[model samples]
Target chain A: MKLTNSMEGVTIVETEDIKAKKPVVLCGLPDIGLIGIIAVSHIIKELNMKEVGYVDSDIFPLIVVFHHGEPTYPVRVYQKDNLLAIFAETALSPESVHPLSKVIVGWAKEKNSSLLVSLGGIGVPNRIDIDTPRVYGASNSASLRESIKKYEIPVMEEGFLVGPYALMAKLSMHSDLPNLLLMAESYPQYPDPGAAAAVISALNKFVPVNVDTKSLIQKSEEIRLNARELMRKTSENMQKMGKSQEYELPLMYV
Target chain B: MPAQKRMPIEPADTWSYGVMWDHISGCLEPLTEFHDKETELMIRIDMPCVKRKADVEVNLTEDTVAIEAKMNRVVQYEKWGTFQREAKFFRYSKMFTLPAKIDPDHSKARFKDGILELHLPKKERRYSVKVE
Candidate 1:
């Protein structure tokens, strides 16, 4: 592996050279409910995307993901045409989130991507009672917010977003990069493919991926069963990161 | 000044591959939540493949609860990871210990949308005091 130290304490290795003008970057790091990982993985599979690169850091867990008898990086970048996605298959340590987010956002900016989209979940305690989870949207730029309105998605008017996506949004704002965060109501400690399907449906409205989610729904149980261990590890990491802050009422709201 | 303790080091071969393999291939332990309420302890288990309440079996005591639920069918994966073999799982099983004493007879449960929720009332209730 050709490891290049792009920034302090961060190394990125490119497996293949990618060339796309103003590509849309998607951040699907493992987080609450593993929604981002599930959605982005599904999208990559449905689009037959290929892995282009990976990000590595000393602070990350000492683990590697093995896929189809081939060893692969836990956190990888995949691309198909103009759509580039960064996803982590393994649970990341809390200490790595900030630096990782900065690297991802900075790298996307360097690539001159038109937009950075973050897919994630908003944990809902009563998720079991809801048949179809609702998707909420938040953007770092006014034009993207207008695009969200044009898509007719419910805007997250007022709330604190915790975890990696929050850091990415903050960095995006500082860099003046348009970013969108699409989150769905999900079970706090389980993989919810139903929520993932809902998020992808909303994404289709904006990106026109036209990917069908019926298969995702059909395999929801299997996904939930397989993702339990990762969910457990991610839950521990989330606790370390103080994800409960998402539920707290902001002092500025008063 | 205090010196930091050095971490232990072991040979790479000392780690048991079987233990790690078994952990990776073990039966699903349904994600659960335990909430301590004023009057009761609420436990919620997310078991997605369970089709009906009949498929679930719950054994409860004053301080512990054991759950076993059979899935509607065996969930199988082919060529999983480096194993390159088929793996099949049929059920979910887990046991949890409660923090406080619970009244087994007074406990109530409801299963909906593959989620099992149990409300275990505490044996002793706390009386609240109003301050002047």
Candidate 2:
């Protein structure tokens, strides 16, 4: 197999279902990588789609393949007459995300992705603990915005996301693909399945995926407690070395 | 330097992790409840984030009680950003080693008004029953 330094205009990962029909792209990074992963994975599992392949990368942001395993990116596709592409990635350092722009743009073009949606989380202090997370929506095209607006979700007022997901949103706009980003009130610094579930609820309108929402809601405490313990260990380790992993937490505006 | 000056600018213990968690331990509210029959063990989870009871997950086994929630947070916004990039989520996970044996097969769980309640049926207490 030949390799490329970056996301190529054509896919190096061959499709086993090439002759089946048009494809809907849905992706996720998993609940651990970022908050968005849980959302995208929820859609994928709820939709009962097949595990195709992954865009492998051993870089700072890991992207491994899946056969019968969990997805890492909260970005995926639910196929129908209209294809929906979910753009979800762990919100990490900006420099580490530059490659995302290159790869996703190429992937979108090569895959002919028509509609793209990037789901993000905006951390808020007050949202540290709650049941029903709130979400806001935005789009690359006005019509796409209208589509999401039909659900009465709040528009992503005035803010920015800087990473592969954001890059894809920007690239999709210029690439002729109608793109959008649905952001939620997330503890950007923490693994927020609640936020992810909320965003997924808002998104179920377009792609039509069915998620029970019960499991995600029920497991919230377990998720929080585990996260707390992890943080305690990390904080202790950081202190012992007189250093910190600043990149471990999410950056929320609220 | 005086004792006051000797304090570190940021205490590591004060931080949950180097990343710091969103839900504060102090903010954690107490969750306790009572049940009627000997069959149900009233379970009250402190979830200020969840709005609807339908979003909670509860599972019971012969000797275990597993519950999960993606609780919602009361949201507010402020516009001060120190970084312009990605986010890290401190996911919540708590595994409670139950103190009693529970009926893993037959159990009732409900989420009402943001609170998740589980009625874990105690085994036939074979001793708690009588016949005429």
Candidate 3:
């Protein structure tokens, strides 16, 4: 394992020696509704993935998270078989987003990852009236787009995507890596575990993961209540990143 | 040692002092959003774990709104943090000072999917003037 602590800002460190053949990289960064974080955390818990590494940076929050009687970094990497997930337990500041995205894509490129999937949520005004939130897909690769179509997930044709996942998508566009984003319609300010469940179900269709959404649905209320503080902090960060732009239409539809 | 440089402070950034829970009352502040429209100001509050709509209580005035909801069951946190231990929460409560004066008599509310939406009509009406 090559442990390179970059001088640029963010560093991806490998605490345990890991070797996987063309692993699939999954990102569960904090965003609107805390969708990605919730989904990835559930996946990590259900699959019993092991923590192999963590992300360290001076720009990150100056706090350590204690889990299961052990102190861990806010952002950590977990692995189960060929699946690799980067999960962030705390809300990231807006300034650290660019360098973090760069480091993640660069590391994925170095690993020769098969695909990079970003799980997130899209805020919708009428989310209260909808029982089952719909998931949308966007990819930089043609084959992935075909796969999305094959899976019958709606494609996000045109709109502004603002946040870390958006930056990762743009950065990976210039590289050979294939990046895919799956976002579910969710509440703008509240933690929506239902939306996270929807995204996970959608991801299960393409990714080789056997996970059920029934437990997620049954414990939706508890998840929302437990995730309140993170959602509040993430909402404030979203305001800093101009997340409302996602609601605006593209200037040129053609 | 070199002095650390601090980021510029903005008004909105300092608005929240980061206190959203009360240990004594065992009540939490729910996530809320406000939208200012042409005629009415809309406010939405997310109250998860609230089983029935009747359990929610809303009190409105000309320029303020208060909401309280009872959870379906008491939730116990074995470890909330280093400072808090075995905390129990049974309700959600919050109050907001509105941006504009609202006609409390004409305001409407709807609760669905654990979300409470309130439509408050502005007290002052806009009149179209004839151009000479």
Candidate 4:
């Protein structure tokens, strides 16, 4: 049962019939520290999610990632229970981000998703000195803000967010769909598994996933080593997106 | 879009899989960054899997910095991601050319959380001259 979804010039090809009931859509695109990607990847592996769909666009890079013995799309969709995650194995070009975000939000709206969450990292200069990275939250809706407050997650007070998650937040503002961003303090250049683990722990408080973060912490070194190339590529994209603006203070007086 | 033109291909030696691990040396290149500050130039290198500070070595000069560290154990990946090859890495090695010359003698280094931070004082110091 293959279903094709085309919107804003980006198509999502679902290979299997998805029977999720108001699924919570999660996005884990490549960004600083590869935090979101690592966290979402761990959840997918722990839950043994099945790859049911994939995304394609002309503006995307011309490449395919080989996992095990099969070649798969660089950007793919995986599902487990009511959890649907969109994971990116390769870096997204700056030009493709707008269309991709629009399509994802539109698809979420079409699915009548209960909530949409975007996991990412906030680059902190003193990450080396910090033992455990802190997770911060931002949302486009007031109810989601209350949920974040109830979870005791710090609200992102004043700063510019630049990347895929930033675009998602902006586009979801017009729609009734709530968009939540969980960003952990992370190293700007290197892949920070500690930061990923921190965000995962924070996300578990509200999301349905009950993932054990012990293995993630124990295998931090291995994850960092294996993700070096991806991290390097993500860093290049971050530079192009002016990711350093995240550290700058916003000029909002009110 | 206009008809795409066929571009000339580069040599095969330059067509790398973009992997961090070097097959010949069995060493991975650690991610590193350099910050050129006013008084000192700081270089931070991320070298995970390196357990003890004794196993890490750093060589600093006025214009360059070299680092090598041994992992706690040999890391083996039978089919690592896209680069389908069985390989083992024992250490992490990397070197960088500095953007500005520094006083190596006054440089200081510290290792924490598997990250090595080197602070090299710039040789040319700025004096606060009164504007007349």
Better of 1 and 3 by TM-score: 3
**Error in Å for residue B79 of model 3:** 2.5
Task: Highest lDDT: give the candidate number.
Answer: 3
| lDDT, residue B5, candidate 2 | 10
Candidate 1 residues lying further than 4 Å off, grouped into runs, are: A1-5, B1-26, B77-87
As a whole number from 0 to 100, the lDDT of residue A204 in candidate 4 is: 93
lDDT of 3 by residue, B25-129 (tens): 788788787888999988888888897989999998898888889999888888877654788888988777777889999999999878899999999979999
Q: List model 4 lDDT by residue over A1-254, tens digit each.
A: 36456766788878878889999999999998999899999999999999999999888898987766688898989999899999998888888888898888888887788888999998888999888999999998898899899999999878899988998898888777888899999998999989999999999987969998889988898898888888888888888988888877888877
lDDT score, candidate 4, position A180: 89
TM of each candidate vs. truth: 0.89, 0.51, 0.93, 0.93
Error of 4 at A167 (Å): 0.6
Relative to the unseen true structure, what is the C-alpha lDDT of residue A122 in candidate 4, on a scale of 0 to 100?
Answer: 87
Q: DockQ (Cα-based) per candidate? A: 0.45, 0.03, 0.66, 0.71
Candidate 3 DockQ category?
medium
For residues B7-81, write the lDDT of model 4, one tens digit per residue.
123246356645566755678888877788889888888988898899999888788777889998998888654
Tell me the tens digit of each residue's lDDT in model 3 across A15-38.
887788788999999998899999
Reference contacts preserved by each model:
0.72, 0.00, 0.83, 0.94
Candidate 3, residue A85: lDDT: 93
Supply candidate 2's per-residue lDDT for A105: 59
Clashing pairs in 1: none
What's the candidate order when arranged by decreasing lDDT? 3, 4, 1, 2
